[model samples]
Target: MITLHHCPQTRSMRTLWLLNELGVPFQLRTYPFDRTLRSPAFLNLSPAGRVPALEIDGARMFETGAITEYLCERFSPDGLGTRPGSPNRMQWLVWVHFSETLSQHTAALTQQHVALREDHMRSPIVMKLEAARLGKCYAALEARLATPDENREYLLSSGFSAADISVGQAVYMSRHFATLDDFPATADWYARITARDSFAASLPNDDGIYDRDFYAPWPLE
Candidate 1:
C-alpha cells in the first residue's frame, strides 16, 4: 500500500491531489506544519525533515516533483504523465517542474508574512520582492494559457496532466501572498483546473498555515 506523509496546504498537497486523481487507494498520514517534521522518526522517512515523504513498494521517497513523476509513470503514465518520445513530453516536464519556481517565492512570502508572527520579525522588502516574484510567475502562466493557436484550457496542448496539478497547487498557496487580478488568463486557468473534484478533495480540513485568506506585504513602518 502507498502511504503519503502530508502536511496540508504545503507542497505535499500537490501529491495528495495527484493521488486522488489517480484513483489509487493510499493511506494518508497528516502532520502539523511544525517542528514535528524534525522529529527522529519523521526524519527517518524524510532526511530533510520536509513534508511529502512517501512509502511505496517498500521504499521511501521525498520531493514533490520527483514523486509526481514516479507516481504518474508507475500508475497513470498515459493519462497524468506524458511518456518520453511523446509529443508533449518536453512541455510536460517543463511545466511540472516550473511549479517549484512559483512555490519558492510563495514559500518566501509565507515566511515573511505568516511564519514570522511579529511585525519586527518580518522584512517589508522581502515580502514585497517575493510577492512581486509570484506575480511574474503568474505572468508566465498567463502567457502559456493564452497560446494564440489553441484555446489552451490547461497548461499543455495535449490536455490536463500532472503539470496542471503541480502548478495549480502552487498557485493555491500563492493566492495568499498575491492576487490573480492582473493575470486574467492565469486566473481563469486556475479556476478551471481547481474545479476538478480531485483538487477539491485535497483542500485542508483545518487551517494548516496562513490564518488569513490574503497576506499583504508588510508595509514599511
Candidate 2:
C-alpha cells in the first residue's frame, strides 16, 4: 500500500484527492503542521519539511506537482499518464509545467496570509505590489478560460484532467482574487470538480485550515 505523508488542508490534500479519485487504497500518515515539518522522521520523508510527500514501494517523493504526476502515472494510467509519443500525452506535460508556473497566483495568496499574521512583517507597500501582480495574473487566467464559449468546463480538452485539477485548486484557493462570478467559465469548471463524489471523499472538508478565514489575509490589510 502507498503511504502519503500529509498534513490537513494543504497541498498534501491534492495527493489524497488523486488517490481517492483513482480508488486506490492508501495510508495517510498525517502529522500536524505545527512543528511537524521539522521533525526528524518528517524531514526524512521530505527534506524541505513540507506536506504532500508520498512513499510508494519504499521510495519517497516530494512536491505536489511531482507527486500528482507520479500518482496519476502509477495509478491513473488511463487518465493522466499517457505515453510520451501519444498526442494526448501533451496534456499531462502541459499541466505539470502549467501548475508549477502558475504558482505565482498562489504565492500572492500566501503573501496575503503572511501579511495578515499578527507577528508577520508585512508592509502595506509590499501588499500593494502583490495585489497588483495578482490582478495581472487573474486577468490572464480570465483570458485563458475564455475559449470554448460559456458551456465547456475545462482548461484544455474535454471533461476533467490534471489541468483542471491544477487550475481548480489554484482558483478555489485564491479567494482574494475576488468575485469568481466574473470568471464564469473557471467558476463553472471548479464547481463540477468540487461536486465530484471522489473529490468530496478525498477533501478535508471539515479541516479549519482550509477554511475561508484561513485563506483570508484580512487582518493585516
Candidate 1 wrongly placed segments (more than 4 Å): none
Local distance difference test values of all predictions, in order: 0.92, 0.65
lDDT of 1 by residue, 1-221 (tens): 99999998899999999999999999999999999999999999999999899999899999999999999999988899999999999999999999999989999987877777788898888888898999889989989998888898999888899999999999999999899999888999999999999999999977688687888776732
Report the C-alpha lDDT of model 2 over 22-82, residue by residue, as the tens digit.
7877898777657879989888989989888888888989998888777777777667455
lDDT, candidate 2, residue 179?
41
CA RMSD of each candidate after superposition: 1.2, 3.0
Q: How close is every model to the real structure, measured as TM-score?
A: 0.98, 0.82
- Please give the range of 10 consecutive residues that has the lowest summed lDDT in model 2: 210-219
List residue ranges in candidate 2 displaced over 4 A.
102-104, 111-116, 148-151, 176-179, 210-221
Give candidate 1's root-mean-square deviation (CA, Å): 1.2
